[model samples]
Target: MTAQYDNLATLESWNDSFKVSPHELPGERQMRARRVSGFLRARQAELPVVPAQEAASDAASGIADAGRKTAQIEREWVSAQWGLVPRWVKSEKDAKLRAPKLLVALNETVSTTQAFRDAWLAGQRCVIPMQAFYVEDLRGGKPVPTRIARVDGQPMGVAGVWECWKDPQSGAELLSYAILTINANNHALMRRYGHPGSDRRMPVILGEGTYDAWLSARQDKAREFMRAYPANWLLANPVENKKDKKPKGLFD
Candidate 1:
């Protein structure tokens, strides 16, 4: 989408707004964390999820038996470590070294800006699955937490890039990924969500029915998938999070 007034003028604005990607500073990640929300704290039950692969497989099968088998099976939610550790990383410690460069991008390969330029061109595309994301309301000065979700309430599939990094030291491999971002300074939803310190930016939430295209699309056409999701299709609710009571500091 073109500049929405919620824009920061740059194609990729640092998420200066209170809105933060679950992957961003994903503090205290797990060896395996449920893709379903609330895995962070024991506040709810994990839900049976329809894995995107199964859905695609069912659609592609066309065979009656395959369809029947798919109908009888339910996929569990995905469990992935938060935050991206690049393919070249040697260990968690090493990945942390690259996080500042690989964690997120304004838009992968756009204007050759992202550090993962070669990987992006090689079609190292992935999707981040989420129920809802949190953002801070900075407009009022003091930060207020807000939960943001699709108005339709379906899980969001955010655009991202992924790669496999093998540790030269131990031959162990790690899979990591990062969310793509885009300017949203003029967006009805985002402009209203962030504080002046970080207003008008957001992740590149993909459009409905675009998941497969994102994964399989050729690199030259990949940027086509970077379009901004409309703000009206989303809603933000003010919420509370006392678990980490540390008062947020500037540049947090």
Candidate 2:
């Protein structure tokens, strides 16, 4: 599974839906392996101020100004590296080598996995806001990317965990997070994706009402929210290029 996803485009959506403001809105609309946005608890009374980055054409494009905004004491939006970097990492070199391998932590073993166990036990949970996530359908004998999103068109809050790793020599801090995935071997919609003979898995997409609870839930209670989202509530469409509806040799 690629585990790639898209992010919110407007500041209003972040404010109205998630009820938090971003420290720095990600420049890229589609979230990949680098720095991405995440919603987590705020421990400070004051948030930092960054200059707004926008042009006159921003309104025409329907994209909001990339400005720093305040957040509630309970929750805040922060940019974190897509991969999880455990605090125990001895060197920056080791961190880079280990991050890619730790992007998705299995819910079944998160509590025991050394890389994620500390974050899980410490209740460092977060919500990854996304417009949609892409999955590959291999039934046709070749990978075809499919975009799965909520039927209501609202952003999805995928469950995750964050950590702060400090460089021993430079003392610089690296904020990182990882998506928590669950087995989808029996899922109605998700089971249709992934390799046919292998075990299928998907990110834990949290419900609309569980944002705050998920960020603060104890380890035991957090597991209660790891269930699969209803298949009917989601819609899937095969990604197609604008120039051509059908790619050359895709079906041949």
* Candidate whose TM-score is highest: 2
For all predictions, the C-alpha RMSD in Å is 13.0, 11.8
Deviating ranges (above 4 Å) for candidate 2:
42-73, 241-252
Give the Å error, residue 119, model 2: 0.6
| Clash pairs detected, candidate 2 | none
Residue-wise C-alpha lDDT for candidate 1, range 1-252, written one tens digit per residue = 211112122212212221223333333222122111211111123323445666456445532322212122221222233345556554667665665455466673433754566557656666665556666776677777777778976656677665566777778666565667777777778777654656366777776445544555434446766666787899888776686467678348
Candidate 2 lDDT trough over 10 residues, lowest sum: 62-71
Cα lDDT for residue 207, candidate 1: 61
RMSD of 1: 13.0
What TM-score against the true fold does each predicted structure earn? 0.61, 0.82
